[model samples]
Target: MRFFKYILTLTLFLALTKGYGQDLDKVDRMLSNYPANPSSTEELANRIKNDFSNDLERVRAIYKWIALHVAYDTKALGKPQRVRFSYRTLAELEAKKKQFRKDLALQTLKKRKALCEGYSTLFQNLCQQMNIECEIVPGIARRLISEIDRQNLPSNHAWNAVKINGKWLLVDVTWAAGWVDYSKMKFHQEFSSAYFASDPNEFAMKHLPDDQKWLLTDNINSKAEFASQPIPYKYFLGKNIKLLSPQKGTINMLKSTGVQFNLQNVPADTEIAYHFKREKYGQKVKSFTKADTLSFKIYSELKGKDELVIYFNGEPALGYKVIVK
Candidate 1:
């Protein structure tokens, strides 16, 4: 189980090239050895601005720097703390909010650690300093299969959306920085570029914003649909694989003759396997591949309500809830 959790965190980010064709490799390499100590967000933003001439590169620099340097504060998980502010006027309220954001960003920078809020705030502040438009988006993030179909889910996560060349791109610095090892309650500082300017449709898989306006898409799913979507594990991260069939997160085995899964862009050399929660050993599933698509089926013999976990080359890639009547 721990191995699965670790694998889940190792997902890859696809390099975004929707509008511009600038090579991010160069941007990353140039800022690879950035100074560890920066007195303030202004100094860091100035450094990035001086290094990159374009808005995309500047945003990438900020995203990469924070992803590489900042660590997720695991100790602060599940321990709720709140701060109250008193402001009779709208102007005063706005001023107080600004100060609060500044304070939180600075605290995260000084400690080199933060939860999602801290990560999003710091990213937004740096972007604003660089004259780039950025906003902190509050939403529900679904990672575990247990989160599927859970009732009355609250907004539990925060990320950012930045405007580049008149288009808003999604970024989740908290997830990009790394994942938490629940068994050890420790944070690992692995940098992933997947969350930087991710596609809105793909970003919607794990992130459901409280405000649909931030979804940045007309084909947005409702909260019910989002909650019922499949659980994409970390193995899907760097890979170009796509789930094509059984799109729903929860499947009724009684209505369907058999559960069939169709995926795209799966490598030829990849080995596939699956298992029910009651099964002791994983069964190798013979997959049929035609061009870039791969198809497989799970029989009804292994029935009842259980989890169906599919693996790619021995690593968990997708999970679905199976219910048999």
Candidate 2:
């Protein structure tokens, strides 16, 4: 399984683009140095199919390997220019090492120096050849916490947005990878899978997918506009108000507008949620459970606000209104 894990991941990021500027001679050396896969790419595909009849298992295996094997380069940290890279540039340099030969995948395999593009491209190709649904998404990547208009940073960073069981999940093999110390060259194996299956809220803090469609939510703040250009808006802004769990006391939910809300999904052993502003007025608080209504207060209500914010499980899980006032 360990070897399987490594090969499968390598296969996933195993694609190459045709033309110059890619390492050519390096590729030749790679092909000559390393023998063919233990199992042919096609046979490996079949093996994967049998081993992982379930999608999640297969994806988890791939995620684990990428995180563990690939090393992140701190030298490249905040360096917009691609001075060093993964397989893609590795191939280019290798080709140069062997004196400018047209590059190929066989060569990239020889010396394992790849940039983000090479990793993503290779992963995309493996998915394609294996009939796995995958795509390499590019985007304006940033992770500014507060509302900042701009930061002097590299706009280009690439990652994968894969479809698993009809659900799109985010995976950043690059960030997951840990590389050598900036002062010295060595490998660190502390990989983070947090980038895999990440939430749109968290993802926006780091990587911005090149394709807007890969972004999971239209409700995300700092998201590029869906139709055209990017529109930087707070997810908790406009109708997206957040609920602060009353620390001193519990609050009751009052309904002024008719909105469909599920009480089951709400936090247990807490206060009530009210629809102060909905499309239609005339809402009343109804006690669904005996324990839910007790110790909760409706001391104050939001008026003329865009949306009545509510809290559940200490997080902003849902948005209640479109516009309050």
Candidate 3:
């Protein structure tokens, strides 16, 4: 009788442990089978199994692993030539670029020759392969008014909307995956997870979703009203502060003095403008503020600080090489 009792207990322990082990493996298998891009349809279906192998660890594991596995590519990101690029037709591009044997994510990772379109497309492909639901969103990053070409207007950028924990989270695997510089060439191969389950309010300034419905309670075509033209006064009028205040985490100014307060590594075309919290912005200005070209404030006075975000108008804020000191 005693022997039988011990044997039964051991058997149950072994069975439970074995089941747990299988689940852990299932999660890893789901992620590894597909490319980083979220467009692999068949593979994505298989991954759905992992999302449920262990309900307790499903969300935590998936979110952490993705953010950890992939990285953002800052150096490699920029305006691709104005060719007609489409995400729905990536398989066609792969066929034409180098046959279906090479996927956009794998190729882009190796060569680091991808634009916002390429990055977003690759992410979408990988997510699809893993059965992760995602979509492409277009938005403005900033105006391309540089010495090379001042006439360039606002361009477009793309990212993903993933369903995690029954919530559609905005993620930009392209931006999340930081860039790597290999000699003169760059290799984009680092993945971040914060953007995976990032909040809409936090993500919008940088990654505008393809569907505004992802974040909004109501349907509104907010992008159409998003000013594509350059708003000079916002930044042009502020004074420049040398350093960010210790408590404020903000650098305010009274006039545009050209004192560069690096808005961190915000996306290109993302303007750094903030409105007075007290000011009654009409319906147009109430929900969101205009994207401004961050410049040196003309007058130098540190009165009050404002909240900040990466407003994507043309491209993801992956470009600005100028670092904020």
Candidate 4:
């Protein structure tokens, strides 16, 4: 009887651990083979409604479809066009806003491209049609390492907050769609599910919504604290790495003996390295891994206001500003 109980527990554990991935894979496969190229948001919403019964699955379908099909508009980013609509009454204003959102989504669908606003508005519109509660969250997103520790950043980005099973989950379809290669000035259509239903703590690392209520977590004390966090790349979150030390975005070398990083859940074979902006080649930082935890230290000649980057498996994973007092 005890043996049978132990086996049952192990089976449940395995199922709990692997079920989400299996479900996501099934959804991806189903969507990939879907025949219709939806010409309008209504048609797309209807297809999603018919195909997915659960709220989570329906939202996932909308997110996956938009992330895969839509391209980021690079030209619009440089020269944004604005239109003004005149309305006399509050009801008229509300109606116009609703119509405006629908128009934006349809425009994005027709063009197959959009800015962050377009991505978010389309997601919100589709969620509304599907009877899922969602909101367009406007905020400041720290994209570049140079933006670290900078004061009073302009609200430059927007994402979505979706309510599934009475819980608000965050989604960034704009980022999931792809990244803009600034060097070549091109948008790459690489679909990543990392931003879908991300942890509030992890999402707060780079995104601070204009409204404090949208943060969804009390771990981040204030906007200043959010601004003062190390820039985490998609790889960091994708791999589920935990940054355990130097929590502040800027490190003071003069006050501390040396810079040491304590990370958790790092793969044993992963190579870690770091370099300043002035260095051509990165100096490898030897890490000691024990039970999925890794620790490494950087002892180097450093000076004032240097940009320090940590590389994981030859990819830039984290960025911090180093200050020598």
Candidate 5:
């Protein structure tokens, strides 16, 4: 009788483990079977539902599929030779926006490429069809270090806010797809799921949602606060460095006398360096390292427009554009 009881316990353990294992297996299957070309959205949605039993898993599956499959559209993002907007009035603009959103999903799927708006809309549409709550929040994305000081820029970016297990999560599929090679003006495929369900505070560093509700945190950031926060790039995140400072790279010398920035979690042995106008200026830059935070200061003597390139160790990490009056 004791032997039989032990056997039954072992059987239950095996069954439970397999039940948990099914999620991993399902994800593998879903990813492997992902279509190379466009397919019926409804059919794809049904397949995702049938594969994943839990809402969180479903959301993850969808996010992973899009992040791995979709390519960032460089042609669409490149600056055009001419500026033109067909809609002159608010009513016409609204109509055009409505139609544009309608086409984003289809165009993205067909081409397997998209800008941030298309990526966010595609993610939202997939979530909705799968009975998950998601929203596309349009706002400012300060991706380029040079964009830090620019003003009067329209809402130039969009990202998704998804609710999973009753908690709001932020995701940027467009960025996850890859980063733009600034020199070549081309997109590169670098898959990362770090943006999936990212921390609200960290997400706020780079993305400022037009809607306050999408902040997803109790400590909401005002426009002034957002503008003051340092730009958080993937390099900073990867190095586990927390930035504090001018909140932007493009600083007007007239507005601010000196350029100062703060850093946290910097390694004791890791060397920080800078180059002013491509000339090594490590000795000229003042730095203080204490505990986990490192602060650097560089006095500005700019007569016109120039760039300050920052280096970590020996490699270029970030660049800042300086404008002087």
Candidate 6:
């Protein structure tokens, strides 16, 4: 019976993730065929230039190569700065800053390892060399499910924005490269093409840009909305879950303070569970009359950052951050 249930679950998952699997497979093939360090940045750029005339094609090739070749630098995540310069003149400072960027680019190319900034900077440099307009956009990124409720944290990540044929698109080479394993404190190499030219609404779920212009879409998400929305991972897309309230993975506690979601094909026996302030709110939360719609209200005395999690059969499915102040 257990084996039969397992098969049923697998079939359901496969049905939901069919399109996602195809896209993921295509990205895997591209990365697998990517060449190793091609002597220098210019050599690789010229190679891509000669092979692809279209701007989008060139960007795809470059993004895939870097995603496969470069590994994330885990040690420098929160470490203090290693470079401190005392310049006697403005010219010296300016020159030092320029050289610092050059050195960083060389290190990322030669060693094939870098933190998020290094990844963004390297992509920008390569793009500039190819006459593609790219800018490094620094901002805060939600890296973990636990961070869904945290507040007042400084910006700790960087991504890129490129103007392709006069239209701006967002990119994150570092995320495309891989994810960091907190237990081992090392990077696990993986390629995700979703970060390349992602839909602005989807991208804003986990990434909050410091500058508003970089939102890169007509429908801009406010900071409050960003904070309230669930961390948008590829899983949500793969599983085909449609979120309702706290639209765009964000909620306005200052206003309505209601949360809602709709999941398809949920089992009749299964119940919707919730967690708040690190404790499970058992019977206090009510069950859904209909299997598809899940709704709940936030009621917490805690005044700062707090988290609300939705669970099914003891496994967490979606999370939201709420600020009481």
lDDT tens per residue, model 3, 1-325: 5335434533443343343454544554555554555444334334644555543234334443444444444554553444444555768776565433236555554544465666666555555555566666665443221211122334356666665434454555554555556465565555444454443333432333445565432212355322212222112211121111111223333333322333322344444333233234311111222243233221222334332222233222211111122
**Clashing residue pairs in candidate 1 (N, C-alpha, C atoms within 3 angstroms):** 12-237, 12-238, 13-194
Local error of candidate 1 at 246, Å?
A: 0.8
**Residue 260 lDDT in candidate 2:** 33
Best by lDDT: 4
**Global lDDT scores for all candidate models:** 0.81, 0.43, 0.40, 0.82, 0.69, 0.68
Winner by TM-score: 4
TM-score-better candidate, 2 vs 6 = 6
Model 6 bad stretches (over 4 Å): 1-31, 85-95, 218-222, 237-242, 246-260, 263-317, 321-325
Candidate 6 lDDT over 75-154, as tens digits, reads 77778756889999999999998788767876788889899888887888778778999898999887565665456657
> Candidate 2: minimum summed lDDT over ten consecutive residues — where?
225-234
Better of 4 and 6 by lDDT: 4
| Model 6 lDDT, residue 191, Cα | 80
TM-score of model 3 vs. true structure: 0.41
TM-scores of all candidate predictions against the true structure? 0.88, 0.45, 0.41, 0.88, 0.67, 0.68
- Tens-digit lDDT track of model 4 for 102-157: 89999998888999999999999999998999999999998788888786999899
Stretches of candidate 4 off by over 4 Å are 1-22, 254-257, 290-292
lDDT of 2 by residue, 57-158 (tens): 455445544444344544445555433334467777775643321132223223333457545654554455456688778876642222123334444678
The candidate, 3 or 4, that scores higher on lDDT is: 4
Between candidates 2 and 4, which one is better according to lDDT? 4
Which window of 10 residues has the lowest lDDT sum in candidate 4? 9-18
